[model samples]
Target chain A: MDQRKDDANWSPPRQHLEIGDSPADFNTGRVQGRRLTGPQQGFGQLWQKTYKVAIPNRTPEQIIATWKAEYGRFWPSNSRFYAPVTGIKPGEVGLIKSNQGPVPLSTGVLVLYSDDTSFSYMTPEGHPFAGFITFSAYEDEAAGTIAQVQLLIRTNDPLYEAGMIAFGSRAENKMWEHTLRSLADYLGSSAPVDTSIVRVDRKRLWKNFRNIRYNGALPWVRKVRSS
Target chain B: MPESRIAMSVRAPKDTVRVIDIAGELTAFGEGVLTEAYEDADRPGVKSVLLNFEKLDYMNSGGIGLLVTTLIRAQRKGQSLGAYGLSDHYREIFSLTRLDEAIGIYDDEASALATT
Candidate 1:
């Protein structure tokens, strides 16, 4: 078999997530030692979502470079991505403290792959969604540079699936739309973002229904109830 | 670096199994080809679909996502999906992404065909 050097762009095999040096302000407990989960491991219906915006002047490489350098700055105000000290490279873990409805959900993602034009994140256990989200920039003949965020996700558990059906799905769409708009605005573009969402699979994995035990919002909600 | 476009061909070596010989890079660009090849291989009375990745040069996260989608497609059709000829690097990738749980990995064509 021929071995290509592109292997370096992928993260090394890991049994569980490990958070390295990150800021003290970030909540890092939920991700440490938790196993990574993909769409197959999730409990809800599978979804593929894509959001893209055209940037007039930048190249794919330039757009990707800026996207990597300022990854969290493009998020909606309610979401906070705490990038690791090593930046958005392969094998690094990043913490996320974002709001899901009224719940302040804390979770993290593993940087699964990274290169000049693209990077992808795989969610750890207990995240609202289990899947991969890829950010990429590509050159288009007519549109010039296009920056895109594509997600293949399923809700992590029954509770999250209920939340997703209630309001989380719409909020998730708005979140990415806001992120793409923020990125485009920062890169000197006001182009309208294009969004496409597809339900890839309608069946839910009943086996993974137990994943609700690790839901990050549970502890927070319990704390509030006692307070 | 030269551009590497994905190429795929389907063949049924036996009544129960169909093999997709995939070559070149497997990325988003290969989606349509992969889908077409998979459809061709998933004919009636075929119980298993095996992917022959000996000629696969490179694969990214997008390619991995494609595989997941393929697995979903196979499941929906009540057919099993397996793969062989993956390099050590990609084998590890399969483990990391936990795709190995759903798709069987074999060392060669004979081993994959013998089981399925």
Candidate 2:
């Protein structure tokens, strides 16, 4: 077997993320010791949300290059993604600061794979969703060049599921829609972003109800511990 | 660097399980075809799905994410999921993502088909 194939396509095995020093405010031990969580480990029904925008006349490679460099700048205003100084690359961790209420929720994602046309991030424990998000650009026969963000996720815990049922899903859709719109604007296209959502699973994994213990905000610590 | 493509075919050699064989590399480009095949394979009275990855030479992160979503879709339809013929490396990939815990990983089609 050619080992280079695996080396080129997969992130090196790591139990936990090692976040380097950066000017980012949210990276202070927030991601340390947190196990990476996939959708199977989450408590809510699974969802796959795909957001795409067509940026005509540009090659997929060029779009990906710009997307990687300007990743944080394309996010919605309410959430701030603090990319590492070295920028998005395989095996790096990026901190994300978002608000649930008065408390700021600090979480991070591991750069699980990076290549010329695509990169993916795996969430750490306590993130709103447990899963991997892949960002990529590809050429569609009719669309010319399409930049897409696909999220395969489930709410991380019972509390998170409750929150999602109340508001998180809409907020998440709007957030990514804003992001695709921003990316389209950056790429000089006024095309409306396309959003497709699929409810991948309707059954909740009750076993992961205990994941609330890892809640990353001050507001949830006592609430989770008491119950 | 061979061009990536996943040729999928679904069959039912047993009453309760549907076996989907996926060959070639699975990446961003391979998802739509797989999704279509998965949806087409859905049938009443099938209690489980056995994904045969024996001919799959490569799977990137996008492919892994696609698999997770596929698993979720299967679960939603009340079908148990299992996989067979994953290379050792891909098996590790499943373990790292804890997807192996969600679905059984088997050594062969017969074993996976026999799974209860």
Q: Report, for every candidate in turn, its global Cα lDDT versus the true structure.
A: 0.91, 0.82
Cα lDDT of model 2 by residue, A41-92, tens digit: 8889888899999999888889889989999899877788888788887778
What are the TM-scores, per candidate, against the unseen true structure?
Answer: 0.96, 0.87
Q: Any runs in candidate 2 off by more than 4 Å, and if so which?
A: A1-6, A22-24, A218-227, B1-4, B39-45, B110-116
- Put down candidate 2 lDDT per residue, B29-112, tens digits, no spaces: 777877887887789888888889998877888888778778777877889888999988888778777788888999998787
Chain A only TM-scores, each candidate in turn = 0.94, 0.91
> In model 1, which runs have C-alpha deviations exceeding 4 angstroms?
A1-4, A220-227, B1-4
Top-lDDT structure, candidate number: 1
Say which candidate scores most in DockQ: 1
lDDT, candidate 1, A1-227, per-residue tens = 46457788999999699987877777777788999998999999999999999998998889989999999999988889888787999999888988648788878899999999899999989999999999998877778889999999999999899989999999999999999999999999999999999999999999998999999777766888899
Q: Which ten residues in a row have the lowest lDDT in candidate 1 chain B?
A: B1-10
Instruction: Pick out the ten consecutive residues of candidate 2 chain A with the lowest summed lDDT.
Output: A1-10
